[model samples]
Target: MRNLKTVYLFELSSLLKKKAYIVTTVIICVLILVVTTLPTLQSIMGGENTGEEGAFQEGTFGIYNESDEITLTHLGEKLPGVTLLPYESEEALKEAVLEEEVSSGYILKSSTDYVSVVNNVAMYSGGDYLMDSALRLVNEDLALQEGGHDVEAIRSIMSGITITQEEPIVLGKDVQNNYWVVYILIMLTFMMIMFYGNNVATYVAREKSDRTMEILITSSDSNSLIIGKVLASGTAGIIQALFMGVTLFAGYRLNYRNYDEEILDFLNMNVDPMLLLVYFIFAFTGYFLFLFVYASIGALMTKVEDVPSATTLVTMFVMAAYFIAMFSLGLSNESIILKIASYFPFTSFMVMFVRYAITSVSLFTVAISYGILILTAVFTAFASVKIYRFGTLNYGNTGSVVKLIKTALKDDNGR
Candidate 1:
């Protein structure tokens, strides 16, 4: 035990002494700080006031008139942000949407129930929302005019269905401010972990390919060496995350100073500091598990050229897990796939943290998921250590995956 401790400390000290590590850390910290501050700076420079009227820019819409009563002249005057271009046929409007002459335009069919809006672009661009809202307004106005309903009567009916959406008082403020910061923080944490976790694996691979691992392993056991390196990399990643978080917080304060009370109330309710700490712990543990396995694969490679191919399997797994977590946000925790992913070592860290942050997750579930993660991490660490014990001493061309596994298992049995 003492020998293991000695080895761990020695490896950590050696890493600390390396100038490259310090330089890389500084570079990453600077990058994170810059990236975090840019958005706030842009917001300040741009100011709160927008020159554009409404959410979207004014665009020409091609209105295909099938009925003689509905003319573009009256419709164009009624709509505020749209310029109506009269098209004789639906084909012409469809061609316009396809040809990029128009962002999006609608075809008013003979049937009153349906108005088809051509949306080639993704929904995020705000074009889809604008088109849908405009079409609905036009339909309502046409209906009232056709029915010969009095303007006052139409207004009364429209005003009768009052939608009172009482914004939930969160942290003494409204829901909008409450939810945004928490969501951003959660996403940032996940990204940082993934970024640095890959770095740790790559670092190990580079050392192995350069024949530095053998020299380092001579003075340190694999377990001690891997733990020290993983810890150092994890610490660096956490520092980057914290720097960005602080920068963002500062930016929010400076930029939104006038709205301080509302912001504070929103943050106070949604941003749980304890949740961040738990997420970090889980992120580090799950990341280390994958890093260890990745390093083990790296050990089987003979050159830096081999590192990419060797690590591709792990990369795919990580990417899939990342996408799944992102897609599963706001979904029920009891969802079969999500529940299974929450307990799966590869995905548990990101998915479970997201699930916990967005919804009310039980402490028992958190504990159980983390417990499984810890056990898996320990097992991976031990297995990788045994593999490194043999693989570092190997010479010549890289061994086959089967041979590497066989040798690693054999080394474990011999130990």
Candidate 2:
């Protein structure tokens, strides 16, 4: 334990002082700040993208809606970018438009089951966007009528359901861009695994290539040294992630303070603090878990140049799991591959992280995945320790998998 602490502290301090690691950390922090604060900067610069730039002049249209108990006046109140001029009679509505009292006229031809939008010009660009929304609202109203729901019940339901999901069963309306946020988080998690995990292999390969492993192994067992280095490298990654996360949160807060409704209509930085905590924990564990594979690969290679090719399998697994998580995260009936990933330790980090984040996955299921992941990590680290001698003392390619397996077969007799 004392030896491990010495090695761990050495590795941590070495990585923190390395030019590559420091540069990468600085770059990531800059990226987080830019992504989080861009909307606020745009608003300040009068370049915010609210999609309301070319919107029609407000309060300019005449409305004649006589489909149900819902009056034209009520519907007009809902339309944000345009004004609806209500009339006692359709004649008055049409006459006002023709006489230039209003910009144009709308006569909703509705039925017990259908809603259509008609216009005077026969050419309405923005009208489609608005009418599509109104049509969805009308359809939802018709759906609730079958259940014989009262006004209060209907209003309660209306408060949540929008045009997109007739029923968002897994996530609520309050979760704006839930899929997007979680997907980005998954990618970020994989990025950390790739960047820092690759560094583990690189560190091992560097030590071997420089013949530093010889002196180090003389002082300490290879397993303890490798484990110590991995622990330290993972600690550095956690520190980097925490810094990036704090920068994102701080930028979000600053943006919110200067939030302009017209500019920030598309900006909602309201990430659930609970979700952020989950993301950080998953990223920390997942990156550390991936480091074992990388360290093993590093121990296999004789040269630092061989690190990337040696760790190709790790990259492939992470990419596959991320894409699968993208496809299956919020689906009502998740894909079979995702279920498989949830059980497999290699893929569970991403698949299970997304499941718990966006879906209705229970805490118990994620806990089980965590158990499998930790066990796999331990097993991999032990196996890496066993094979550490195979390539570290050797001087060339070592043919990785085949040679490592052959060497493992002979460790008892050969030594």
Candidate 3:
């Protein structure tokens, strides 16, 4: 216990004193703050807000209607709230787009054909699709007129039957509302684990390569060394992550009302406090478990260059857990696969919390899942100490993690 405390405090203090760690944490928090406040800044600068429902209101388009059959009034009616400037020729329409006089231009060849001109295509540009829909409506009207049919009468007939919900349908939860929240959290967890987990492995490998491990192991027991290292590294990572989360939440609150209404669905910052607490718990435990494995992997490497290769299997497992959680997001809480994953320690760290956040979950179920994860983490930490002890001194050709574990067990039994 004394040795564990000394190691934990020393490792933690060493990590805190590093310029790279402190600077990286500050930079990330600053970025989160700046990104969250961007909407407010844009609004203050008088930038145009283009939302889905009001997209047409934000830009102007040029039109050269060569087809006398298609009137400006009909086109205007099709695209409500859009400004259409008429051009004398197709060349003029194209020139208007090139000169930035309009967002885009259209030259009507006939009721069925038209040419669109734009200076550049945007990632989310749907102006051409909107124009196509409007042109299609105009062509249909022109065809109906040629057939001697009343266009308004046909429109009224089509618009007569509309469906309306008599009452609001209630469900256990709304997946769409909570999806981005879980997605962001999952990504945050994955990155922290991958980055800080590697930090642990690399640190151990560096110590081994420098002959520091030979001196340290003689002074301290392997159990104390591994436990203290994992605890200290996990604490540092959690501190950085928590600070960033606080920065994001603070920025969101400071600029809450400045955000576009449509964007509120995905950027909704009204997360439940209880859910956040549960996420922290799972994330902390999962991080601690992974770091111990990382530390053992680090002990197995004789050279610093082998760190990446040694950690690849653990990285793959973390990625698999990430993908599994993402895939299961849209599934029902009672899904057979989700039910199994929520209890399985390897996946429960993400799956269980996701279930609790987006849907209804019992306290008993959460307790059971958490208990399993805690036990697994405890067991992994003890087992990793054995591997760490064997591998740190063995410094020879350490095969895979599986083979190392088996050999470590045999060596321990021989003792």
Candidate 4:
């Protein structure tokens, strides 16, 4: 463990000075800031009001009335925030629609029938729905008028009978509010482990390729070298993550009022602090565990070009963990697979946090999961040092992982 701090500082300083790392971090921070500020920018640019009364006013539509039975004025009134332009003929309405002067056109054949036309339909085309709704109300109005009933009086009475539900007293987590947060955090953990894990592996491979590992081994123990390098990469990753996280928080806070109530509810700020703590514990522990394993894999190869092939096994394991955690989302809380995954070291990092966030989990379960993760991390770190020490001396023989481990143990026993 001698010179552990020196090795850590040297590797950290090297990472901090890399131009690619600095630029990537800055670009991600700026992107997060811009994205989080978009709602505010939209409001300032005279975007349509998202308030309830103003929500329906989206676009203009052309209407050609072939039937003299229905009133265009009353139909327009029924669809608020929508501008209705009347045309003299169906051809004129179609021309307006083709020229993009209106979103779409409606040809009213009679009180009960109409033909809708548009140049091209997009995913959210709603012109047909609007026309149908307006015509239904107009037909009802026409019927009431023919019966000598006051249509406006009846409409007012119906509109006044609004039914609203009281917010329910729930004893469960709000999945709608927590889904995005959990999804984002899970992705963050995956990306960090992948990016930084490969970085540590490549660093180890490069050192071995250039005989730097031989020189370092003479000056320091294998434990210090491997632990220092992994910690350095982890520290750099933590710095970049913190920058992005703080920027996201600050930007969201500045634009809080610009978002609608539904949005506010979905991305609520009332997250349980304990959930975040659990995430960090599992995320960092799992990160270091994988990095140590990647470093050992790096030692199994002499050429830097072999790093990708060497680390593929560990990468697959990480990907499996990510996929399983994502698949667990929205599944029933009684899932036996998820419960087992919460204690399994490899998959627990992402799955346990997700379970804690969306389901009712006991504190004892959380502690047990943590205990398993920490113990596994320690074992992996020590095992990685042993493999790295033996691999450094036994170069040019990138044998199978199982064979390499067996040989390392045989050499250790002979010593």
Candidate 5:
């Protein structure tokens, strides 16, 4: 027991002292700091206030129309920011537009023709939202005139169409907020699995390739050694994750003091704190399930170089689950694959949380999903331990997963 504790401490301390660990931590901290300072930096750079200074925009449009029915006053109401100046002659309007005295011109070339709008820019560009709205209104007015409806009748008909909502719709905000949570959850899943899961695999493989397992077995039981190291790696990862979380929280508060929204509070629109906690716990379980499986696979490998090839399938499987969760979102919450994925342990880490976040499910359904994941994780962990014990004893290259498992089960050394 004492030797296992010593081994656990040595493994964790050795990893913590590595250059990769230290540098990665520092880079993450720096990124958090940069994110914290972005708003302040933007404010310092003197950004544009589009709404307040809207009137400062140039370009007065000249109009050539001999209509007594339409006036600049009617057009001004439809087009908020445009300045329309009337010219009696088409030639005068054209010359004004060319001289840049007026930026553009709208001419009724003939009574039979539609209004022509032109700008002097070298390449034709879609101007702005206001311009598009103005053009649509002008076309509608012209069409109504052709239909023998006056401006007053058109206004009456348009104003008669009203929107009535019994309950205010917030479905968009709910989905958007859910997406924000899902994105953060996916990042957490990737980090945990890539760092701690791969760490367990590589650690086991390194010992095997180094022939250090012979010495390790002499001091402690295989179960104790594997469990202790798994615990140590998990503890180390949890500590680093907590530290990063705290640092980010502090940076967020210090950086965005003036900002009203916080990540936690921002997502409070649809999900409750308890539900989020459940999501986090279930995700951790799924990670643990895979981490131990990775360790067992590592035990089978005779060389460190074999880890990537052996574990590539598992990595791809996890990645596929991530993509499913990513695409599912609010748009496909009711999908058959997503529904199946939510109950399965390998994918529940992301799919379940995402589905729960964007859609509503009963408490009974959550309980069943949680039960299945817990059972799978517990079973896979124990089964992996037996395989780990046998795998460490077998030497040379492991050809296939089936052959390795067959040999492990046949070996009398396995638990």
Candidate 6:
């Protein structure tokens, strides 16, 4: 335990000394600030021309009323962007539509219960849908009046069907923004871990290529070295994420202060503090597990250039799982692939957390998933130690998968 602590601390210090860590952290913080401030900036620039031509032009429609006693004043008030013109007869209305003096028009025949809309132009244009909506409303009112339904009762029923959807609870509070915030946060977490996790793998590969691994291995056991490197790199990634998160929160608070009440009401930002604590615990654990895999792959590489190609398989898996998790949000039928991915070691960290954040996931499921993830992490770390012990000393082209497995097995036997 003492030896592991020494190695972990040494690795952590080494990462802090790297120029890449500092540059990457700063870049991420700036990006978070920019993104958080954009909404406020847009609100300030409100009412600018949308650059769409002919979007707000008034639509002209001819009307022929066979019932001279019935007033059409109510319909005229409802059509804000439409101009309704009077016609002497149905033929006159159709001629006006055909001549393009009006886009379209409606004829109300006294003998028939239904009204016919004369559409000479294509219906794809803006005026068609609006005219259709207006006609439907008029028909509905006519039907209700004919059925002897009270106007007040009809209005009451229409208004009573209003929907009020409640957010799913996470810990003791409701999750914010229809779970989109949680989805985005989880994705960002996965991306950061993958990015810096690869950095750790490349660092290990660089050490092997430069022959520094031999000297380092002399003082530390394989397990100690692997644990140390994973801790250091994982710490770097966590620091970057923390910096970005803080910056983003600060920027959001500053820019959205005026609209805080409305935004909070809309997003339902009532997160339980304990939920955040659990989130951090799981996030860190998941991060270390991924880092172990990354470092193990790095240990197998012969050169820094080979790192990208060697880890392509793992990267693809991570990206596929990420996109799947994103698409699974709000779907009634949860995906079987996503459910399996949530338990699988490498993908579970991102997938399960998102599920937990967005929906009413059972506590038992979270516990079981974390248990599986931790076990997998331990197993991967143990395997990585063996692989690092063998591969660190080897200087050649990248080893085959079978050869690396055999070498690691042999190293484990010796140990």
- The local distance difference test score of each candidate is 0.66, 0.72, 0.84, 0.86, 0.75, 0.72
lDDT for model 4, please. Answer: 0.86
Which residue pairs does candidate 4 place in steric collision? Answer: none
After the best TM-score superposition of candidate 4, give how far the Cα of residue 334 lies from its true spot, in angstroms. 3.2
Off by over 4 Å in 3: 50-53, 136-167, 264-278, 332-340, 356-365, 413-415
- lDDT score at residue 364, model 3, on the 0-100 scale: 87
**Candidate 3 lDDT, 337-372, residue by residue in tens:** 777888888778887878887678878889999999
Show model 4 residue runs off by greater than 4 Å: 48-56, 65-69, 88-94, 107-129, 139-150, 253-267, 402-415
Candidate 2: lDDT of 240?
85
Candidate 5 per-residue lDDT over residues 1-415, each given as its tens digit: 4467777788789878989888888888888878876766756775423343243344577878776555667667776566778888988887887777776677644333335455445453433444556656866777877888887776888899998879557553366656776778777887788778888999899998998988888888787778777877887787778878888778877766434344336724565675687678888888778888789889999888888888887887688778888888747347889899999888887788777777777777888988999999888878787888987778885478657877776678885
Q: What does candidate 4's lDDT look like per residue over 1-415, in tens digits?
A: 8999999999899999999999999899899989888878988997837557543357888889999887778888888888889999888998999999998888889989999989997877667877888889989998999999999999999999989999777697766557777889999999999999999999898999999999998998887898899999999999999999898889889988888777787775577888889998999899999999898888878888988977787888899789878887776464788888888998898889988887888989999999999999998887888888887887886577667766875676313
Better of 1 and 6 by TM-score: 6
Cα displacement (Å) at residue 318, model 5? 1.0
Best candidate (score: lDDT): 4
Backbone clashes in model 1, listed as residue pairs: none
Give candidate 5 misplaced runs (Cα > 4 Å): 1-4, 48-130, 140-176, 257-270
TM-score of each candidate structure, all chains considered together: 0.67, 0.67, 0.86, 0.89, 0.75, 0.68
TM-score of 1: 0.67
Off by over 4 Å in 6: 1-7, 43-76, 79-178, 219-221, 260-262, 272-278, 333-335, 355-361, 397-399, 412-414
lDDT of 4 at 199: 91
Q: Give the alpha carbon lDDT tens digit for every residue of 48-124 in model 2.
A: 54454455434466667776756554455456667666666788876786687976666666632323223354565
| Cα misplacement distance, residue 44 of candidate 2 (Å) | 3.5
Q: Lowest-lDDT window of 10 residues in candidate 3?
A: 48-57
Model 3 C-alpha lDDT versus the unseen true structure: 0.84
The sequence of per-residue lDDT tens digits that candidate 6 reaches over residues 320-405 is: 76787777765644578768887886777777766665566778888888899889888877877777777776668445654666
| Residue 387 displacement in candidate 4 (angstroms) | 1.4
